[model samples]
Target: MQYELAPMEGITGYIYRNAYVKYFGGMDRYYTPFIASTGLNHKELNDVLPEHNAAFMLGEEENAGSGETPPPRLVPQILTNRAEDFLAIADRLRQMGYSHVNLNLGCPSGTVASRGRGAGFLGVPRQLDAFLEEIYKKCPLSVSVKTRIGVADMEDWEELLGIYGKYPVEEVIIHPRIQRDFYKQPIRWEGVELALQQWERTGSGIPICYNGEIHSLAEYQALRQRFPQIRRVMLGRGVLKNPFLVKQLGQWENRLQATGDAGDENVREPETNEDNRGKQSSEYCGIGGYRESEAGTAREQRRKVLWAFHQELLDGYRKIMSGDQNALFKMKELWAYFGESFPGKEKALKKIRKAVSMAQYEAAVREVFYSKS
Candidate 1:
């Protein structure tokens, strides 16, 4: 199973991606938040600046970086219905040394969809078909599409997938939710079943990737059991809630792929050290090498690594974004998801949310990392 980080508008920017790569690295691919057809703002441009994203790709200028694991590929995504605009963006990215781009037709924001872009484009199959026809003909690099199943129902998804199959789409990243579903629960897996059926019927050979709310290994394993053929999965909000999710999932996937095992057995907890076996472990499992209560040294190491990642974010944001407030704004958006991991830290999280200055944010975050659970 290849794990990817789904492009989220405000989250998953270069700073956050790099922070993730440096600490909890395992993602196979990272998509830059969809580049709006309106064009790149200074901040947005910074996101795709080959310089900022160099670490995610291998064979860079120095080819060495702070990332914990082998760096993953970075693919820039463009959200647009205009074929000309897509060609323009693709040209810019190609000039920037990128060889692959993802077309976004899954963004469900009202402002975006109102403009007949993103998921809104799915409502007009004819126009979407023409748009893909032109771009695929003119684009110089490989093209994949990240798209919703339909506008308000799954009825249109089959036709849309047919249109996609007609093109040389590198891959189809299906969210399985119609535009109206927005971000609701219980994704329409029937839509995915439909895609599989189409592949079986026509043998299009184009790869299919699933994107949804997979928050844990169990959710992912269940997905695999239901559709054992699936090998690629994209994760979004789950990564924010638990940064270690992909690392854990990737380890399982790599093991399965390497061993040729069915990987269907129950996943066991990491074995305790010979000296520490049979000890009562805390409920919390940490990304830090040491986890909860195995030992004092272990807990302190966990805190150190967590703080290191946070400091990198703070430092990276202050450099790229304009002021403390801008950095604070971006960080707070992430905290909405990141804060969920610490179940009882609501008050500490509130302090981080209400933080007005960088200093205040730092103090509150330190409390979050340092406070005893």
Candidate 2:
């Protein structure tokens, strides 16, 4: 199973990606947050800069002489309704050594959708077909599309799939939610099933990856049980909520392989022992089995690791942003997702939110980590 980190606009930038690799590394690929090519904004260019995307080397042998490693397999993503602009930015990325690019058609933000980009582009199938036609004819890099099932109604998916099949896209990532749903309604897995049915029935040969609401090993296992054909998945918020999810999933897979599970058809059911595999605490199990007390110790170790990762983020932002206020703003944006991991952190998080200066922010963060409560 291939795991690609979903491109989250504000949260999955290079800085976050680097820090993630340094601490909890398991993602096979990391998609850059969508870079909207609106006349080449400085911030957008900086986001995809090769220098900023280099991978971090952890151990002495891994570091060797250079101390830095090659970046993860990164596919820069772009959000545009115009084929010309898409091709233009893709060509620029290819020149920068990227071999692939992903198109953002799944973003449900009102600002982007209202402008007839992202999911709103699905409303005009004719224009979208033309856009795909032009890009495939002249594109320099492999183009994959990340798209919602529809714009307003589920019926829109059939036409969208047909259009996607008509092109030679490397892969189609289906989020299985309409624009109107906007991450609120249950993921219409039926829509995803329909896509798989269409592809199998037509033999489109275009690979498909599932996305949306997959946050844990059990969720991923359930998805595979439902659709054994799915070989790739993209995770965004789930990984943000639990940075160890990908690593834990990988360990689970290795355990399955060691148990002689031949293929997707013979994948083992998740352990039924509630005591052994409680969803909330299963992440503490590494390669070998861990006792309940060991799990508690592991949780403490994870907290310390998270603290180090947090400091790396703060230092990274400080170097880039001019003012301490600007840096704090970035950290606050991260906590919106990161805070979900700490179940009873409301009080500490509130203090962090109300912090007005660097000193106040540091003190609050320290209290959050050190507090007995």
Candidate 3:
């Protein structure tokens, strides 16, 4: 089974990916946040440049001295509604050494959807169909698509799937949400089931991958029970609460399959209230941290790893980012998910959110990690 880290803008940049890889490496593929292709997008382009992603690059011997590497597991993702735009972006990345890219038809932001990009394209299936046809006809790099089921409902999903089947799409990663639902709806497993049935019914031979609210081992087990044929799993924001989730899932995959068990005893089912996002982020990397049942060494390791990862992220961002504000903006985005894990740091978290400068942000961070409970 292959495990992937889903690309989330602002949350999974090269610094974040590199730090996560350094401490807890389990993801088979780490997708970069989507790069916009239609207009001047220097920021996104710079984010995926070879120098920023050196750790995920190939070894010196394997890469033949070019900054480019072989077909990368560290995949770059592109967002555009125009076929010409996609081709242009693909060629640029190909020149930079990447051989693969993922099309972003899954972003649910209002601004993106309003522009007829991302999931809004799903509302216009004919145009999307034509766009796919043109891109596949001329795109230089291998193309995969990350998409939602439909715009507002599943009424047109069968037709949409048929359009996808008509193309030579390398893979389809389904998030099972419509534009209206965004990430609020508990994942509709039936959506993926429909894709599986359609793929089989048409003998499309296209691979299907599942992505959604997989917060705990029980949720993952239920997904596997429902779709055992699926071999690829991509984790998204839930990893923030438990950075070691991929590692844990990898270790327990075989045991769960052999025993036909529902979940790991050490892991608890996360609350299903998507509105309360902080509740999804946990204290111990989801490994029963600080629990009495766990060994002293295990607790010590958790502390050491989490602290080191935090320091690395803070230090790395400061080094690469121009002004303190940019790094502060990025770190604050992370703490929105991470602050929940530091149980006794509510006031400190507030300070972090309202922080105006690096000094204020770092002071709040120190309080959250070091202040007395």
Candidate 4:
């Protein structure tokens, strides 16, 4: 029942990670938003500063020594096509005391794909294989790769996994969909199932972490029941939409009973539940046992998580905006992914999107959250 936080560019960062850990609390590996490795030099230091906008916020402890504890297992993910560039940033991260790095091959953003950096690289397996060989040869830390099933079609995955199985990567996080589908289709579970069977048969030893379209505890439990071999899962938009999903997945039946006595005698716990017992929220920092009830209780918990996230965003935004009023634009991007968490958030986000200054933006957020309907 191990869980890893999925990286969403311009969305999940240190601020989000800090708030998530403080509240909902069920992430084992926290991945930073992907860092682009196109430009390489000390001149670009501020662009990836651990204290600034970068996803890893270790600089605060590295320099300020605030005695504040670090978040759970923060790992920086890098996006690049050049082998040398990947090695260079890997060296930089090692210098920053990071032990493991994740390569991004799952990003479907048109810009990244157009550059043959993300899913696009899957179409060129030999090139990607060469790139990894060079990277692993010089890399100073352990490496993992987050990738989709294929670039444009299901047929592309066989070659992609073939390339992956040949490497000694720490783990292969797979989202069961082709790149062009872009989340519009149901997850290609069959594709993932095939990969799992092959991995087991080959005894690759590389762990396979499932990802994509997992929205609830039931869904996760069902998957585990069907494939008892899969051990790890990565939560993406599901965690954003329902912060308690991973926590609930481990004790879904008990939660169902706690929420409001379930009467269905047929609702029984699967055999896989015991295997996933360690994944309970209780295991993560001892925070567990939230019963899912009517939507009211759910909304309250959502509000609490959102409040913590909002406060962290405000703090991070202020630091980024200081001496640089232009830095405020970044806040708009933050709202694009997180605003949906707030009640009536769509309207608020729309208003904030058009705001020209901090004052206007504040008014917009207030109107959506504080104004009487």
Q: Find the candidate with the highest lDDT and give its number.
A: 1
Q: Rank by TM-score, descending?
A: 1, 3, 2, 4
lDDT of 1 by residue, 142-235 (tens): 8999999988787888899899999999889999888888998578989999999998899999998899978767678778889988878999
For model 2, the superposed segments whose C-alpha errors exceed 4 Å read: 56-71, 260-292, 295-297
Highest TM-score: give the candidate number: 1
lDDT of 2 at 97: 69
Residue 277's lDDT in candidate 1:
40
By lDDT, the candidates rank as 1, 2, 3, 4
* 198-257: candidate 4 lDDT, tens digit per residue: 887788889999998775556776787777788898988767655666666655546554
The residue pairs that clash in candidate 2, if any, are: none
Can you tell me which runs of candidate 3 are displaced by over 4 Å? 38-40, 57-72, 257-292, 344-347
lDDT at 251 for candidate 4? 53
Backbone clashes counted, model 4: 0
Give the TM-scores of the predictions, in the order they appear: 0.87, 0.86, 0.87, 0.74
**Overall lDDT per candidate, in order of appearance:** 0.80, 0.78, 0.78, 0.68
Error of 3 at 315 (Å): 1.4
- List residue ranges in candidate 1 displaced over 4 A: 58-70, 254-300
Pick the winner on lDDT between candidates 1 and 3. Answer: 1
Q: How far is candidate 1 from the true structure (C-alpha RMSD, Å)?
A: 5.4
